[model samples]
Target: MDLLINHFWELTITGLAIGAVYALVALGYTMVYGVLRLINFAHSEVFMWGSFAAVWALMAVGAGKASGLGLAGYLVIGFVAAMTVSALIAMLLERVAYRPLRKRNSPPLIALISAIGASFALSELMGLRDKPLGWFNLENLRDYLGRPRENLPLPLQIQTKAVFPVFNYDVTNIDLIVLLSAIVMMVILDQFIRRSRLGRGIRAVAMDPEAAALMGINRDRVIRLTFLIGGIMAGAAAMMYLLKIGVTRYNAGFILGVKAFTAAVLGGIGNIRGALLGGFVLGVAENYGSALFGSQWKDVVAFLLLVVILLFRPTGLLGESLGKARA
Candidate 1:
């Protein structure tokens, strides 16, 4: 309690920074659930892939020990690489995994199982990426694989300098960038859904698939678009995550992905704003709980918070459906 009170501002700012990543990842889960009524477990792998892509892209460009304009340029390359890779992988999941099942009119349970399978497959593919290179006698090029199951740190070295002070706690550039970037992305998505023509198609399908089809909204196209949007969000989350954490692994997304899902459920699974709120709430709660107890209890604190919240309001904080969101 004393620790939390003393460092409350610091915890809050840093927590919000971490929460920004969670919120961006949660957007993927929430948006897909809003449209398809199915959880895409493989979405986590999409995030992991993006992180790897970002790292690989930076490494390819020899981005290291950069500062000022050079650092900014490297970041742009990372974001572009991560977003592009995540988007393609997301679209591919829809085409190769979920689309076939949807065509067959598979039960939701079956689709879920497929999602889980796809998640494992993607994770393993990254884990074993060096195996193919080894088989082809490309030992010199396999350094990037870095022992598969181990941690892969970013090549760039980012220094954290405090930008301002809040209640005696300094807010660093990373914190501001993360929080602002997430808010901007969320606002763009919310506006896009509210005003765009394709957005209406998405809302129509979510509201009633049959009616949407009857009204000439292409159901297949809308579904693809949903996955694409989710993927893009996940990709952005990946870049932010790498910026904050500076390290990743083949299975890095597993735990974070679960937390993001909890955030989505906490905020109202289908509500875009709900995801944003839930993520910040969860992040703050985790920090406070850790301060009260210990660092090891952070995960426990987060899930416990979710359970307690759900017990009282199962519909979530802003449990409005995407289809029902106001323009």
Candidate 2:
């Protein structure tokens, strides 16, 4: 309690920044659930793949000593690389894992099993770096694949320079970049979903697949678009994760993915805006809990908060159905 009070502003700002990442990742989970009523567990790998893409892109450009406009250009390169890779992987996951099952009218349970299988396959593919290299005889790629199962660090180090002070806590450039970037992305997504023609198709399918199909909406295209959009969001979140944490592994997304799912459920599984609210709340609460108890207890605190909230309101904080989202 004392620790939290002493560093309230610091915790809050840091928590929000972390929460922004969670929120972006959570968006993927929420959107998939809204349309297909299935949990795409493999979405985590989409994030992990994006992280690697960013690192590789930065490395390719010799970002190790970049500064000024050059550094900014490299940042853009990383984001584009990550987003593109993540989006492609996401679409592939859908086409390979879920689409076939849907075509067969497979049960939701079967689709779930496929999701789990896809997740493991993707993770192991990254972990077994040598197999692919050996298959292709790509000796030069060994540097990038380094130690099959080890953590990969970013090529460039981001300095944490404080940009301002709030309540005696210095807010850094990273904090503003993370928080503002997340807000802008969220607003863009919300508006796109509410106003675009494709967005209406998504909502129509979420509300009633048969009716949507009858109305000339292509359910297949909507599903693909949903996965694409979710992938893009996950890709952006991957960049945010790299900026904040600076290290990643093949299985890195496992824990964070679970937390993001919790955020999705905490906000209402199928609600877009609910995900944003839930993520911020979870992040701040986790920080406070860490201060009061210990950093090790952070996960416990987050899940406990989720349990408590669900006990009272099973639907979630802003539990509006995606089909009925307000403009």
Candidate 3:
């Protein structure tokens, strides 16, 4: 019984950490889908870019070797830098790739194709870009964020080791930070959507663009805001992901994005709270499934759950009722 309890606690902590990352990434999907009803497949690349940006920033600050700043300060700086860069890139992508198609009254398929093309382009750019354009190297960004180890003076290290429990695993500092950051961000976003002027515009656009426009809402501006908000969320998620996993690659976002998208759908697409609920649920389910079956079957379990959910609850846990208001 003790052993089982220990295992359960370990899994719960792990699940929560992973779920937080999923929720961060999933928010981008839910927000974009809420307004445009288009899945921004390029969103994964936005996350990738954010990871790379943080890496470059650390290198520039000479913190690549983990030489400077307390842990909190390092994280704050890295997250802010990453968010800014990623948001800018996401905006550019929307303007260059998505907006043009939207303007032309192109079919949703066309927009999807554009998203795919843009995703590939960003990945290729990371592969080819000389001098490592962002703050950190893509290859090492994950490790830097996750472990963040530095060499301390031998005496200080020995003293610190003597004082602190070496293997205590209630929850990692990284895990706590990620969870808290995700909660704060989500709360702020929820309030923004419910209370702010732009928030109303966004809700209005999602509900009915024609009606929103008739009410003097600027559709283009609202659309841009949606992309920007999604991009910012992705950037934050990318930072958390790297911190948790400790490494990244140019194509890392592909699988993460797919899973997050699944989470969005699982919670009921276009529903804000649904995305949050779906991400955590999927994260716990995936971890538990892997523990029971094997890591290889994790994906199968995720899809199976989705299929089962769709079979019975076609509208998802929250249902399509959320979209009815907009409809």
Best by lDDT: 1
- Candidate 3 regions exceeding 4 Å error are 1-6, 64-69, 131-169, 321-327
lDDT of 1 by residue, 1-327 (tens): 888888999998888888888988988888889889999999999999999999999999998887789988998899889989999999999999999999999999999999999999999998888788868898988787788888898898878888889977989887787788788888998889888999888888888889999999999999999999989889989989998999999999999899899999999887888988898898888888889899999999999989988988998888757787555
TM-score of 1: 0.97
Inter-residue clash pairs, candidate 2: none
Q: Cα deviation of 261 in candidate 2 (Å)? A: 0.3
Q: Assess candidate 1 and give its lDDT.
A: 0.89
Error of 1 at 185 (Å): 1.3
Which ten-residue region of model 3 has the weakest summed lDDT? 151-160
Report lDDT (Cα) of residue 206, candidate 2.
Answer: 88
How well is each residue in 1-327 modelled by candidate 3, as lDDT tens digits?
A: 343345665666678778877877887888788778888899888988887777666555655323225555667766887788789988999999989998899999999999999999997777555435245557544433332222111010000112222244456555677788989888998788887888888888888879989999999999899888888888888778877777667777889999899988888888787888888888887877777787898889888998999899997767642334232
lDDT of 2: 0.89
What's the best-to-worst order under TM-score? 1, 2, 3
Off by over 4 Å in 2: none
Q: TM-score for each prediction?
A: 0.97, 0.97, 0.85
Pitting candidate 2 against candidate 3, the one with the higher lDDT is 2
